[model samples]
Target: MMVQTGLPPMMAKVLVYLFTSDTEGLTAAELIQRLRVSPASISKAVGYLERLGLIRREREGRRRERYIVLDDIWYRTWSVSARSIQLGAGTAQDGVSVPAPPGSTSPISA
Candidate 1:
């Protein structure tokens, strides 16, 4: 269902895990351990989720960053997107459909 959000596979995977965890949050290290993925991949996926307003980052004490998915995540995401639209912002996907990749003839996946 969430793949329709146009997220990369790993990012989508990360988001699903966070959403279904039934906890307030999880740290990057925890995500890496649970997902068995490279730190860079987890970082990239988590960063993307944050940028999309689908996840929240909380800092605890000195060195921990916890990623949380709210129960009303879709509402929060819509609110953020609505605010951006009202502020005259363009979505990153705005022009994605108009171009074919330079070196490849394959159609871009949705």
Candidate 2:
């Protein structure tokens, strides 16, 4: 399902495994062992997911870096995105309230 949304298949598969597991988190080394793939693949996938805020990386008992997906993951993403959009909208409104530049034909000019 995630693969269809521009995610690499390997990444999606790794995520599926994490989602299905009853465990709280999985380390990259553990993922590599279970997925039977090279460490690079898991590293690449985990990096991408972390950047997108879909997952978080943390130390698990000082042994390894664990990837975790909190239950409120979606809510966090949505709230951050909504706040960004709100900021953009506020900037737009400010632009609208400003007088147009001299001799300008910009859309913000009324």
Q: TM-scores, in order shown? A: 0.65, 0.62
- Which one is best on lDDT? 1
lDDT of 2 by residue, 1-110 (tens): 56664567987787777777778888888899999999999999998777767788888686678898867766765765677789999999887877767898774655
lDDT of 1 by residue, 1-110 (tens): 55664567898889888988867788999999999999999999988888877888899889999999866888976786678666554444554555667777744634
Best by TM-score: 1
TM-score for candidate 2: 0.62
Question: For model 1, which pairs clash?
Answer: none
Model 2 residue 45 lDDT score: 90
lDDT of 1 at 107: 43
